[model samples]
Target: MQIYWTKINKIIEETPEVKTFLLDCPEGYTWEEGAHIHLALEGFNAGDKPNRRLIRHMSISTLPNENSIGITTRIKEQCSEFKAILRNLDVGDEMAIFKTHSNVPLKREDKNVYLLSSGVGLATFRPLVLDYFERADNVNKIHSLNVDSSKDFLFTNIFESAPDKKFASQFVDNRKDYYEEVKNLAADKDGLFYVVGSDEFLVQNIEVLLEQGIKPDQIMLDKHARQLPEFLSSDLSI
Candidate 1:
């Protein structure tokens, strides 16, 4: 696979535990909204096989036209080794990106789109929202629901409600309210649901959506095809 090394342009701390690393987009590197890449640390390519510990699957939080590649993530006090190393890296530090792909590209079907996420998982949908606002041709409307227990919501500037833009955004801090809103959104069975978060989060969202009559095909996830059956089997009986 072709690997492109790029330097960090800047870092924006969205919250105490969340950060957005803006990397210099390499020439000829282009991706659609909701794309993700394998971000490798400095020594990832030193050995024959890539070191799994040094590599992370991160969402490309920016669209191609935005000029910079954004990797937004949360690094709490007790995090993994990869995230700890990432948090210490300063601007101008170089990292390699490869195996870029997107499973949740914007699907404009003249239907309202709902984005449900937890904490920093909303980073995966930043580009999708931007893409819809920039060119909302096929989409009818867009609504975003994010639950961050920290209450220090990220991307508030971009997630604001815009009647003219036919977009709305809501932030909640608790799971009880978050699921209530999800159920309300799921009432619109024709709407498209895009979910991003931990496996548990995805399963919870899928279960709620399915229980509310949303079909498996109507929901979109950031997981791979091989990993989807597990999440999509929420309605199946053992």
Candidate 2:
């Protein structure tokens, strides 16, 4: 993947710990929903070995509107270089951006679409929601369930305002209501289901859905990181 330099235009804290980043992509660049861009720090100072830090992948959280790409990051207590770079980034300062890629192409025309996401996983669904609302001929009804770990929920306002009845439910797992909320959504028939989240979130919810009689073929699971177990991989592939 080719990495290009992008400048951070602004950063806003959506929740206490989650922050949204607005980046100024180079002219003519565009991306689709569920696509991700890899970010890296710039300008390593003396004795600052090139921080070949793990490639941080962030979903294209918002649509490409007004020539900017939006990404949301969850701040961790360990204080990583990735977080540091994001924290210190200023307008006109450059950060690297690899072009977007995804494991599955979005099927916007699916009449009954079920979108499942947790925490930063909601980032992956942002563009999809935007696309669904933007088209004149789009006929799909979107059911989006967002799970957050109590303190780190992002963009609650956006999800709450979605016009579709199916898209309005948001889940906060701190109280254990996540499963029930997802169960209700999965009970619907003939919907194309897409799940994006941590491995545990995907696995547990997919299991719940299957237990509730959702066919395996109708569900698509995308893990945010590479820590997924083999059993889950096999299940997703089935």
Candidate 3:
């Protein structure tokens, strides 16, 4: 992987616990939709040792435009390094980034596209969504389902106004039945589905989709955690 030093341009808080960082990339740097880059955090205190933290597999949260790119991250703990570094990041500070890469090819000419995401999984789908909006003759139908644990949903206005067939957001609390709500939503359409989230999140939703009659081939999932046994079942084979 090729590494480059980029400057942090700006950081915006999308929610109470989430922030989006805008980076100024080097001239002529380009990346495709769904690609991910690595960020190296050195000189950070990791327990007793002065260690380096490398965050690979971070998704590009926006299109590279005017020599800049964006990444959105969620704050896990109050004292976490990820939160500390991001909160204190400045405009001129330099950060190391590896070249972008992805196994998924997001170039779809189909008029219908469904984007389903939870938490920071939206970052993986941001570039593709932006490209669809930027094209001059783009008349494709885009449907986005953003699932969150509460009412403070991220990017609500942006996705609501985004050009598409439909846009919806569902907030689930642990006390509520999340599976039933998601199952009802997934049954509304039979189109290309892109699912991204934690492994448990993906597994639960994917099973709900399949139980509701969505074909395995029609559903594509990208999760941060390792694959679960449910996802590895033979029934998923085409």
Candidate 4:
């Protein structure tokens, strides 16, 4: 892992709680589509350490050819302090990135892929979804199921290129049925299942997928901001 520093170039608010930060990709700095980088704030406090550099893992939102590193994050009440620091950052503000790391290969096997995301989990998978259409060959039916509590969907226009395929469900009429709906989405069960979401989302759906007879290797995970449940709370390192 290598450390890199870059200044903020632009910030765009996609939703009230979600924002995307653009950073000038450093010289010779490169990363994969679904790669992730860590952000560290200088004066963040953790325990009694005033100089504690609070760090968080964020997914790279934009494609590699976009010329800049884009980070999209949601400011929740729990991490308000850290998100507030990032939210108030303006253009030219200094940002420290520890490194970009992703072992996910860029190869595919002509199998249908189901991108499953809930809430801010969309941050990690959006770039992968974009990469799928842009890079992979023999790509089969790519389905995206994005669920949010209210009708305020995050990436409404981002995935609009495929009108019939991408499905965004604002759980208003079907407020509490998103989980069940996910099961329905998995019915066809074609190829790879790339699951990105909170711990609860991973634990619940992964169990369902496994019970549905999907192999462990066929399920890929991009667990952001978590460790234990991120790994299924099992011995599985992935």
Best TM-score among the predictions, by candidate number:
1
Per-candidate RMSD, Å: 1.3, 3.7, 4.3, 4.3
Worst 10 residues of 4 by lDDT: 166-175
Model 3 lDDT per residue over 67-169, tens place: 5778788876665665577677777777777756754336465535567777677778777666766662433466666667755677665566533434343
Q: Which candidate is the best by lDDT?
A: 1
**148-179 in candidate 2: lDDT tens per residue?**
76655666666665565445546666526777
C-alpha lDDT score of every prediction, in listed order: 0.93, 0.70, 0.66, 0.69
Residue 131 lDDT, candidate 1, scale 0-100 = 93
Per-residue error (Å), model 1, residue 112:
0.9
User: Which parts of model 3 have CA positions greater than 4 angstroms off?
Assistant: 43-52, 104-111, 136-140, 161-178, 223-238
Pick by lDDT: 2 or 3, better one: 2
| Model 4 residue 103 CA deviation in Å | 4.9
Tell me which of candidates 1 and 2 scores higher on lDDT.
1
Separate clash counts for every candidate: 0, 0, 0, 0
